[model samples]
Target: ASFSHSQYEATISWPQIVAALANNLYLGPQLGIDEDSGYPIFNADPGRLFTPLTRAEYDSIAQRTVYHPQSQSDTLAFTFSNLDLFQLPAGAAGFAGVVEYGYQSYDLKPDPLATQYYYYSWKDSDGSGSRNRWAAAGELRMPLLDSLSLSVAGRYDDYRFAGNSADKFTYSAGIEWRPLESLLVRSSYGTAFRAPDLHYVYSGVGNDETGGTDYYRCRTEEPDEDLTDCSYSDEGLIRTRSGNRALGPETSTSWTAGFVFSPRENFDVSIDYFNIDMRNQVQDLSTDRLLQLEANCRIGSDVNGNPVDVSSPSCIDAIARINRLANGNLYGITVNPVNVARERTSGVDLSAHYRLATGIGDFRFSGNYTWTREHLFQQYTGDADVDEFQVNSGFDIPRNKASASVSWEKNAWTVTLHGDRLGRLPNSDSYDQIVDTEAGEEAWIGATYRYNLSTEYRFNERMRLSFAVTNLFDKMPPKDPSYPSSPYYDGSWFDSMGRSYYVQLTTRFGGGPL
Candidate 1:
């Protein structure tokens, strides 16, 4: 029931230096609806509709019914990459160094009311820009010895949120060692910070079509005044960004260690473990968190019923949904992500491959398996709802995820297959619930085949033709509605390609070689 539309214009201003650097600017107007095609015909609430919304009425609602973007934006960007080799000492473990950098800025024309679905009522009284970010980074690799290698990289970025901004600094380091011809080991540790994207930190957008969440009352104690969305149980009655600013970027400290073992030229096995702990994780009160907030902002009472308002309304609903973590917050002060004490994560990956030669042809295959475990560490409610939640209020992180593929190539023909699996996500947003995302992922397989047909016609030349069929089986991906939670998944490849075909023909430039 969701739809989106975008109109774009791109201008490239590259000169003969084009071979060295390519630069361009993209301008476009975009708008989209990320919700279902209106409300469910059978699920509409009759109480709120003074007049009930009939099935016909619901069906009449249009999907992606947003206005064309009247405000335009331009992303000015370009990349310049080139490498030159410089050998170390003559017979020394030969090594070369490389350096590259890229920069881009997303600028949008001023449009205060730029929003999705033309959702504007006199009630919505704010305007902001389309979100964008700018970044620059560089990296270098060096062979320190015949059996050792090292690499270093760094990046600095600035995220623009309307008139405000946030800065980011990231770095990475790695080294490899080969103690013997057949035994190799490598390890690395680095830190990186992820800036909040447009989807979350900027372009503030909210919907209350459903009364699943509650709001805070930072400025009001009265019942009839314009309290600025402090409602506990009303839909479309509260808002969080009415006077709010964008949030800051989150930071992460990460490290990885792994080794590769190649017993034979045709077979190899490897394993890697990674751990990352993010601080000031940039999570906010989405519908799900808002629901949790109700519980957070609630008021606990004693046997005499002494009234004590809870931190906020989010806690009440969240505790309820999560299988009851008790009626009130044991922690007296309201807890929030920004105010959030901290967040951490850890995981491991295992991948292997084997190849064999047979009279009929050649056979080879590979695969990777992963395991993950996450913790909100700072806040583990003894009474928290673990089974019903996929994400904690402070983070949207999966402890583990893995994907694998197996394939064989024989002459001109080849067959391949791949599959990815995701474990149960923790503390998911309510959107996850509405979309039914607990289902995880479906196993999918795709195969492509290429054939070469050539016939000799000259002394030493022949015409050759090649053709390929992609997604030959057309196996549609699992619709389990859980797992990856992506909007695109019909037949795999994530909107890139479906079952399709292609062909091409070629001959020697001088038509003299076979």
Candidate 2:
């Protein structure tokens, strides 16, 4: 048995410029006359802009003071194991078990000065928030036959926040079989759950960027315009989003089956298939979905022939729009996270390795590839699922990826060459429409490939030096005009930093007991 305890704390302070940017201090009210009406525009209505302030007035309201935010966490854990309690007469024990328990508490406190300057809905009485969670887990493994094995595991977790508590359980089972001397097969099925993180569950108030069109504004431009057709005229919106305490854990079930083949020495290969179906996937409704729901409520019926009540809590919560301009131009909309979506993804993975001995050195080669067959998502329980395979809808998940490496070692020197590839991705229908309207044609991104080389030499038994050149060709990412902010390419899927070189040295001197 073993036990442990730990405590941690951290503090963060922001500069004057950071605070000014966060608060949008550079944007003042408009003071000019309207061109269409030839009328003086002033801060006279809720949606009207305020008069532009002088430099002195702007400085007085900017609040250039520093902000010091702090957070702390405490953790305690206990573990027990009895894998050696039983032994077989042949000296080959085939049974094992283990158990563990842990608890953690977290607290966050914001700077008083920051609270006065920022616009947030936090109302903690003492300017602090806290939450605690505890979990217990156990696992067992046993051999069912001379060439077969089985394993099972389970875990339970309880979380407490402000006087409320919630509990969840997850479990999994797996099996392995060696039917032949050179072949092995394995399969596993598991269920998992994830509680909302502190920021997702207790973040008082914050702002986020959302992509969608303003229905009211769009209708004014074209009387018979459809909501789906309005995306061409929309860029995006900034809005408020808050955490929800009533959220529960997101759950998922996954299964995998694979086989390994080793036909000869120094050579092997493996292939695996995986599938995951998740329910109650925690996510905030996108601006487009929110607007669609609001439109459904206004029509008194949903697409599935279900009745809709405009005054219901769900409807009211889903619709939040602001018109900052007196002429009724939408500035933004609000959204919050909820456990309301479903996602299903399936894929296959392949890997292989081979080794050979040469006159000068020993060479080894390995490669791996993954092909995603399907990636589907449903916004709500009763909504239809949308396929996102091979499309880049801002999720950053590509349909195909592959990598290969070759290495050679001789005496005290080792060298290796590696290559990586990312398959092409298609744009979503709405995004495609927006691009076609702006550029007069359809757009698509092509595949990308990168290479790297590394070398290492050992000076002695205790000293070593290594060097590496990443992105050997200094290849640049492909351009996509659809994304204005990052028109170069998808930074998440491709390297935007270009080529980079690195060198490392290591030395070890300690050999005696401490």
Candidate 3:
């Protein structure tokens, strides 16, 4: 029923500097070398660093690259609904069945330069592949009594790609009970599956970089200097990553129980509890953690000077994946994705909405909040569970989060305000060295909030104008001195942009009243 095609192209250019040659020419005079009589220099050779006399000479060293990639997909689907399965005491049992087929292909071509390394340029590898998929699903719903109903569904999916294939079957069931007109209860259990991402399985070798203070090296080489004052932060070491075609599909089982309360037609609230158990989760070591593990492998201690077992599998793997210079400086690292043991989490969700009509205008209020009770993970079957819900757990996910909004509407105008609260989290992912000196306690970034406001006006049945402001108060991200990386804040959760504004005008050519 649908088909899509996409194409992308990019051109990149950069300057490649010969650091040694430049340094030698600039420092010639300091080293007592006078290759050029009147030229300024400060310690090395001039013949080895002569400037290019023509554009052609300079072009030979300048790096340039072109990359193009394309992809296409097609799908056809059919569904049959409202078919009667059987008769029940209160209603007729209805069934629905669906069938679908899809095919997709992508050509991910990297530039020729991507295979070669430059003094300051990154490297990348090819990722080109295609896949086809087929799926079938069915659902049945039955009403046994006037106030209770039940539903069940099942699905099967098969995928084929690059000399490999995977197939899975999943199912779900749910029950609902409405003892009163204003109250309802529901519960559900389900099993789910996900195929490996195309890029995760098809991407070849790639290289990138990250920068931070090499704490282990600094501590060993400059034992007299305070760690906070160490001046080792510089250009990042090289890191290489690659994909794996042997990755298996991820599977999970989830259960949920919830209830809805509606005391009046204009007000409602719902609360739900959910738990999930996942297996064969695919992942790779984060840059921060990788660096931390590298440090641990060499020093056998955390930032706090606590002892660590350097002979463990994690440390052994870390040592094997990294290469070091003769002076013990980091040279390169290899990080490949792999399937891990398990991840289990449980949480509660609460939401409510209310609407009121008054002489001034119609007002609506809505709010939602989530609380994570527990989060546990294991890297291997026999490994100990790592608790991830506590403070300073080295995970970005917060234990609590909430949002609220209010809106007002009149004859031709509407206005709304919204706010979000990002819960507290550790400033650094490492296990130690975060403290408030005066208070003698660990320091953390407390809850932060942002707000937005918008207003809209309708000029006619088909035209409207709108304006909005995000981060209305221009709140800045919290600063943490203990963070190891540059721009010492969690960029993943917060935006550095202080404030933003926008305006828009919309018009409809053929539609109902606005």
Candidate with best lDDT: 3
CA lDDT of 161 in candidate 2? 69
TM-score, prediction 2 = 0.69
Ranking the candidates on lDDT from highest down gives 3, 2, 1
Per-residue lDDT over 1-514 for candidate 2, one digit per residue giving the tens place of the 0 to 100 score: 5566666666654433334332334343447789999975544353323556677755554434333344555556666666654554423333333344445454455555443434322212112346777778877776667788778888887777656676788899999899997899999999998877666677666554445555444544663654346543465666666777787778899999999999998999999999999988888656655654565555666543457677765566655443245755556676677886789999999999999999999999999999999988865655545566423232435689999999999999999999999886643333323333467234456677899999999998888899999999999877775554434466556657778999999888876321
| lDDT per residue as tens, model 3, 1-514 | 3344454454445455333333433444344445667545464446545655357645544444556777677778888888577899988999998889888776676566665664334677778777899999999999988999999999999998768888999999999999999999999999998888777788888886766556567667775665456665443678888888888888899999999999999999999999999998888766556666667668887665657677766677767887778777777778777776899999999999999999999999999999999999776565456677543334566889999999999999999999999888766633444445565244467789999999999999899999999999999888777766667888878768978999999998875865
Q: lDDT, candidate 3, residue 126?
A: 79
Each model's lDDT comes to 0.46, 0.67, 0.77
In terms of lDDT, the poorest run of 10 residues in model 2 is 119-128
In candidate 2 the C-alpha lDDT for residue 350 amounts to 98
Per-candidate Cα RMSD to the true structure, in Å, reads 14.8, 7.2, 6.4
lDDT per residue as tens, model 1, 1-514: 1122334444322111111111110111223344666422233234544656565544333122222223344445444433434555422232232222222233222223323223322112223345456667666677777888877777777765657777777888888899887767888877777655443433333322223333232212333432223343333333333223555667778888888999899988998887877665654434435444443344353112334345323344344432211542121111122312356666688888888888876776777777765554432223232222242232343445566655555555555555555543332222222223355332221222222222212222455555555555554443433322334232222344456766666567653565
Clashing pairs in 3: 26-42, 27-42, 27-43, 27-44, 28-42, 28-43, 28-44
Error of 2 at 59 (Å): 13
